[model samples]
Target: MAAIAQERYEDSYLYRLRHSAAHLMAQALTELYPGIKLAIGPPIENGFYYDVDSPVVIREEDLAKIEARMKELSKLDQRIVRMEAPDREAAKKLILEETTLGQGPEVAEYKLLLLEAVPDGETISFYDQQRTDREGKFHRFLDLCRGPHVDSTKEIKHFKLMNLAGAYWRGDAKNKQLTRIYGTAFETKEELETHLHNLEEARKRDHRILGRELGLFMFSPRVGPGLPLWLPKGAVLRDTMVTFLKEEQLKRGYEPVVTPSIASIKLYEKSGHIIAYRDKMFPFMEDEERETYILKPMNCPFHIEIYASQMRSYRDLPVRYAEFGTVHRYEQSGEVTGILRARGFTQDDAHLFVTKDQLIDEFIGVVDLMKTVLDKLGLKDFRARVGTKDPLSDKYVGHDENWVAATEAIEKACQTMGVDYFVSPGDAAFYGPKLDLIIKDALGRDWQMGTVQVDYNLPERFELEYIGEDSKPHRPIMIHRAPFGSLERMIGLLTEQYAGAFPLWLAPVQIAILPIADRHAEYAAELKVRFRDEFKLRVHLDDRRETLGKKIRDTQMQKVPYMVIIGDRDIEQGTVGVRSREEGDLGAMSLDAFIERVKSEL
Candidate 1:
């Protein structure tokens, strides 16, 4: 029934238009490049892309030609028709005959290779765009696709071919590279134009671009890929975020702790991560005595060790240990795009060890804390993803009854809180079921930012126990939660979400005092000291020997929240002119009044 609903959703008018645009693109490719071997063409989020093996290397310059052919074909108002082939042999024969006249053996070889991969007992389908119907109408060209496309080429009027790039045949490094062309379509020209505008805006706020422009972070080729170096400005922002969360955690009964960056390989083995997540983890190093050590890929195992440090009773069941732990993982080069997917990052992680009876309440508390953090960060649009076990997979750990209980506890908590969530089968961690928070950025792209996992296997593996009312040893449940999944990723998202204009409290340089001349420098310095000492605000005195306009422009470009312009008149009256990044300049105000405003904002 869910499959049917998905199919119905895909058959919407917009989806069909995008799918038709994909076919038109493939048709244009075959027509322009005669013998282009097609691999796959499927509709994606905004539109569709087709992968092709071309004789000549395709570049951005070739997109215009393909797009022109598409426009000409669309003008013909061709009717798209679908057909079914009884067997692979029949499908191959039809494709070979149609493509042989132009491309011949190369096209036939490609068709045969695809034909051999089709599963048995499944009907092969093709779509064709017909030109005319004078006496007996026939399709000018056709390609294999299992699709629900638009009625005709006319529906693809508001479409465009975006760009081209090299992609692996099947997204695997082992496969041959193919030229992939991306494009987008919409039901109306206005919608397409709006989407393009949004794309342009997104490019401006792209973290990689903003990171460089703002001098926040950088990557060095010598240091290797997927590793970022935070500059002073960036470090200030990171520290501010960490300090805010740490304070919040402390107020909510979390005890701060620190852990080593590397641990013995045996630790991961006991946590079941070495066996389950070996591919994503860094390799172990062999010492002189043959001891193996690994860069910790996660902090849960270390916290588990802390929990089992000594014997505990039911009174200490709800111990919450928090850490700003840095971990390293070996992500594939292709997957390491930016700070969002880095090699080394810090997790705002916490582990709560509780008795069986305290599981639900503790789980609910974690959820509440997650909401509080998100609210403080101005993230109100989010939904929870309840990751459950996949019965067919061997990746899951823990007993079946424990898995059931953990999944039920999370669902009950979500229900009791009246929060909307969706169940995602097979997305659970190896140890147990988890609840992940999915946040949408300013560009409307969804990111999985925070998570809370319920683990029963870890306690059993480590032999964690507590004395209960009956004076018997009982295993405690482990709850793993990270509000900001990783500090690096959170900053990257915030950079784009806020468009590099962070809130005043979080901005690296909250206020810059720009002295109009050298004579006013002393007053500016005094004001900076006053703000920094009293309010603990990040304030800078711009004593550069530059004009007031240039100074103001420089500070504006840096995106400092506020700028105080000190001139002779204001200095004489012991007042300063206030200027804001968002709002224009306000009239002169006393130093105390300005400090009060900063305090209010903070």
Candidate 2:
């Protein structure tokens, strides 16, 4: 069913239009830079990008020139024709003779490499675009591609080149870097304009910019990339989430546990992480006794060890250990984006060891808890994705039966829970199949948040067991869950989703008190204490020697949910002037009335 939905998009004209737009861009690049070597160009989720080894350096300013040329080429009505080569030798000959556009063999470097990498049984195909101008000058563009393109370049209109980026060839650091040109296309001018407008709005909501402006977090060059230093406000937000999740876990029968930040290398080796996840892990360190240790990349192994430490019967079959474990991964500098893709982050992690009979119930409980968490976070737009191992991939461990059982268990739980999910192959963890919540924020961009994985393999690898009714040892199933995925990434999403104006309960400062004058400062201080201590609200007292309007503006800029102004008349009347973030100022209200209003919002 999911494949059908995916195919609907893949078979749509928009898809072919974007694909042909890539070809149109390539044609423009070839005309602009004669010796440019086009590597690969494909239409992506929201746009398309083409990587090319250009003869001249491409800059942001060059994008305008490229777009102008693309616009002219798109209207030329050149026929987009697909051709196939009979064999590898014919393909190579076509690439050198036609794809190079008479520029020389050196320009076909990446294309020949692409041809060599193609499987023997696959058809060798190319996309050919050729035309003669009204002035009788012949112009042609051909490239090696398996194309499902629009029939004419005239259909490749309403497109804009977005930006320029550097991508390593074949995504290998050892290979030469190619210039990546990103662009977006739509079927109509209105859609293209809307997309460009959204791109601008996305820039404004960029967490990296908002993180610093809103005082959430910061990245330091000295501390290293992908390591965020949470400011006071950001720490408060994190604590709020942790407290909420911890309470939810306690209610769901999850016991808290603490583990070391670093574990012995042998521990990871035993769990198979040393082999499957070695690349993402930090460098190993050796102690005085020649024992090697690695910074934690996952908290699952430690939780598994704890479960194995105790001997249990079927009566105590399900044991859940929850922790806010801080882990580090060696994310490449290019891959790290502020807190969203941080190297060091805390996972709201838990591992459940349960008998096969208890698997469905426990999995349902985890999904319920995840829904509750998302509701509280105000993330209502989301979908579930079931990630299964690719049949051709050797990255996974465990037997085929174990893998099948795990996958079935997950699908059953989702079915029982009536949760809609799409199947994604090659997205599973090395251990087992999993379900991930893909959230759409305010900007309509998808972020993979909470996750739950059913792992029979891990328990088998660790020899985890429980005594059955007949007193025979049986292997237990493991459910690894993290509803928030990670605190840093969640906070980043929240920041962008709400644009820093957090809800009443989740806001770092629920209310700010501004004093009208020096004499009002005393009353404001007292109100702050009442709001903070008596009402248990995160309140701030703005008693700075600044103007009243300035204080209000500053508080509004901070995105505080509420503000109370204490003045001579308000202090005399035993009332405070209140202002709401979304609404304008409400007239003076009695202290009790204001408290009740705040309580209702909470």
Candidate 3:
């Protein structure tokens, strides 16, 4: 489904329009600021951006200037034309001349480098926007790029420069930094306005802001970047999710296992992760004997070692080991975004060892489990994606036959479950194919959460075997599953999904007992204790000396599901004032009635 969406997007006129708009923005930048060496510009998921080494520092205020120039240039109705170069030399000449304008060869620095980086014998192309202004003056802007852009500049009408950020050339930190200008374009004025409005809503629901406001989690620069400190409420939330998943796994006959944070490098080397995941792995550590160890970037290698600890028979064919394992990777400082893309995170990881005959059924079970998790989270807008290995890539492990079988098994399971999915080549893990749940949030943004991968390579790499019905040894296929890809990522998404007002069952504090006055504090405390002991509910007693209205407002801001208020009248009547986050005030209710309400919410 993700692939289809991508294909439709790439094939859409909006894509061409956006791509041309990027070039238009680049043109405006070149006109407004001389000696701006242009880097690559491409249309991305939600918009397009152009990276350039500007002689003058470009700030947020500069976006408006460039955007205004783009608007004026777009009104000129320049004809867009595609041109091809016969050889690398000709391409270099085009970059030094036509693209250089009056800035000389120094300004063509990145363009020349881009041309040289193009593989030998590959077709070289450029896009040229040309038109005669009303004053009969001819104006044109030429850029070195593979072209399928809009036919004219007039098509890039509705666009806005979003912001500016620093981007390293080709995403390499060692390379020179460039200014990246982000912007979005739409097919119609109304659509553009709607998109801008949605951006506003998304800002209001931004997880980083809400994560702190709701007190679910906190990050301290004193510790480090991307390593979050789970506060009391946040810890409870994590425990709630873990406990629920553990119970579900228990019902499904999965055995719980634990692994360490760091492991000997030999383990990953044997599983082929050391090579395939070298870039993401933290720096290797050396022991006295020259033995290498490193922080684990994945849990699969450790689980594989456990599976190989003892010989197995067909009767014990499908062995499922589950763990809420924490792993660390060296994410670039700029790429790390709060907990969503944290360097240290926990994966609700599990590995299933099964025979060839059991592959389809095992895959079906994994998919069903993933679906159950998504459903429980109240995430209905999602699509299944089968990520298969790229045929042209040699970096992938395993034989072609194994890759084909694993891909087919995942597809078959989706078919059996009647779940719609699309195949996305080149997205598979290095060792196997995977099924990803791409969730669409309230703001129409897609997030790739929860993944189930079918692997025939890892077992083969480790030579994991079991005795079959024929009394012969056979390699067992492995299923790598993480219904919540990572607790941090899932919680981040959920925080934004509910806007921090979590469901009653998942909320850190399900109920709050607020005393209307200092005199009523005693009754409120009693009700809180009773609620906790009887229902095992996460209840809090707000016995503060503040005014009743202030306490109620504070509880509401905390997003507690329900609040029980005890005042003189309530204590005298043997009742409590019940107020719900969503339903406002429900007046006075007996303690028994409130318990039923909480139970119903659960």
Indicate which candidate wins on TM-score: 1
Clashes of each: 0, 0, 1
Q: Which stretches of candidate 3 lie over 4 Å from their true place?
A: 1-8, 34-37, 53-57, 85-113, 116-124, 134-137, 168-177, 284-292
List, residue by residue over 1-602, the lDDT tens digit for candidate 1.
01111234476788778888988988888778777788888888889898889877888988888889999888888989898899987888788776555556676565577778899978999888888667776657687888888878977888888988888866887988888899998888888898898888889889898888778899999987888999888999989889889988888899988999988889988987888879988878988989999998999889988888988888877989999999989999769978999998899999999987788888888888888888888888888889898878997767888888888889888877666688878889888899999898777778889999998888888899988888888899999999999988988888989888889988989999999989988888888887889779898888999999999988988889999999999978988899988888987998889888878987
Q: Which regions of candidate 2 deviate over 4 angstroms? A: 1-4, 8-12, 34-37, 53-57, 92-123, 132-139, 168-177, 391-405
Worst 10 residues of 3 by lDDT: 1-10
Q: Write the per-residue lDDT of candidate 3 for residues 1-602, one digit (tens) a residue.
A: 22344567888898899999999999999999998899989999888999999999999987888999999999888999999998899888888888889777999888888888899998799999999867898877999998689998988999999998899998999999999999999999999998999899888888899888888788888888888888888889999999999999999989999999888988888877787789999899998999999998999988888989998999997999999999998999768998999989999999999988898899999888888888899998888888998889898877888888888888888878767788888889887899998999987889999899877788888899999999999999889899999999999999989989999999999999988778888778888788889789999998877888898889998999999888898988898889999999999998788888888868
Q: State candidate 3's TM-score.
A: 0.92
Q: Which stretches of candidate 1 lie over 4 Å from their true place?
A: 1-16, 131-137, 171-176, 391-395
lDDT of 3: 0.89
Cα RMSD of predicted structure 1: 2.8
Which scores greater on lDDT, model 1 or model 2?
A: 2
In angstroms, how far off is 184's CA in candidate 2? 1.3
Quote the positional error of residue 519 for candidate 2 in Å: 1.3
Clashing residue pairs in candidate 3 are 1-422
TM-score of each: 0.94, 0.93, 0.92
Clashing pairs in 1: none
